[model samples]
Target: MLRFIRLIIYAIFSFAPLASAAQDAQLRRLDTIDDNRGWEAVGRLDVDGRGFCTGALIAPNLVLTAAHCLFDTDSKARIDHEKIEFLAGWRNGRATAYRWIKRAVVHPEYVYDGEVGAERVRNDVALLELHHPIRNTTVRPFDTNTRPREGAAVGVVSYARGRSDAPSLQEICHVMARQQGALVMSCDVDFGSSGAPIFSFVGGEPQIVSVVSAKATVNGQQVALGTQLEVPLEILRAELAAGNGYGSTAAGRVVAGSARRADGAKFIKP
Candidate 1:
């Protein structure tokens, strides 16, 4: 996985570094309610009690994250969705809202092959439907936007390994390059940052442009890699609408919330 990630970074390094002035933003913890305002939708995803990744609410009940987060890190087998939980706005050991994933749908092209590459990163997106909708006064879902261009300014908020108590915000980061459908940015991200949303503040509103997929180094400079959300996001949404993902009832049950259904337990299309 590490080697393949390096390869992806290397291939895009010629255009990977942004201006030094645009690369110094640091992660600031959003530990207080005031500090966490407008970002209550970003959450920590607990997958099957084994490990965690970052996720964010995109709708009343739909949580967006990386597809790889649902697979076991060791055996590469799919993890049971029943044990997964979404802790929105987690801070001081608590969350603004807690909900269990009723079902999840990964991008049709994503696969957890224990390796990473630009192609793999391009398709690394998923959507999990919560058992109940989160309609809070403060915890509002964010809107999605088109892919960002190189050198575009963006920001990210996420819960990582050492900063798991609350999600930290990297207020300013530059998109370094776009290779195929993958994006390389100068954002600070680590393991738990996977599925963390990358936001573009156009028109004074935050819209999701990408999600952290992997971290890599190019010429000793670290960078965050992610997928361009415009296409894969729609794909996952369509899959969920078709009732092809795992539903809230059981492992094999699939429901499009109120309409469609499937007869299998598999969440990812084989």
Candidate 2:
């Protein structure tokens, strides 16, 4: 089968050995207030009004997602940060909190254009600074954890293409393997699922262990891939802290910049 990062969703790559199957939980809709409570931080990222991806708030004003979501699907160019919006706790027809991105940064090692290999997969993460912090009582931002071990059970919450109106949670999926700093899990994912937070409920609280990068097939069984999170997350955080690797926004216009490289980077055109 062909292996390439599909622009709409997955960027396929080779895998290590697949672990024995673990019974994964089915997707459950977080439609009601009770079910969606404590998960309001997970939101849908509408990229330039053209497509959307899943993201979650790591801080009051910081949102984490796949770096690929910030780029143009066809042109392979960085999308204007102004055009991106975070619909927090989006359910039914309305969102609990609507926020705009002020600036954003991707992992320094990430390349928006590529074959989406293991190298890209391991670094496919981005962070966005919201113009306003989400301080809703129901929407609490999540914490991060190091990558789980092989065979560790993980969960995923996301807004996919078909389930764009609300988020769905798959409570149990096993880490199939760890390949060159990338993780292969049995979690269910699809289009618009990129950047979804992969959680590990180690102490009865969901901590983000990884961020969904792509969906792939492993030995005839479907699997999802993610970055290891620790190193990449630290890298992104440092970039944001240093006042670099960001594109700014105001009044529906982007202050020309790039998130990939300090030099020879593609600047967003007005």
**Each model's backbone clash number:** 2, 1
User: Model 2: C-alpha RMSD to truth?
Assistant: 7.1
Per-model C-alpha lDDT, please? 0.81, 0.81
> Over 4 Å off in model 2, which ranges?
5-15, 249-270
Query: Model 1, 133-207: lDDT tens per residue?
Result: 999989999999999888889999987777766789998898888887988888999878889999998898999
Candidate 2 whole-model C-alpha lDDT, 0 to 1: 0.81
Clashing pairs in 2: 5-11
Stretches of model 1 off by over 4 angstroms after superposition? 11-21, 250-270
In model 1, state the lDDT of residue 143: 98
lDDT tens per residue, model 2, 1-270: 234533312333332356785788999999898999889999888776567888999999999999988988788889888778888988886778888888889888888776556778889999999988889887899999988999999999998866777899999999988877889899989878989999999999999999998887666777888999999999988999999865654543333572211122121210
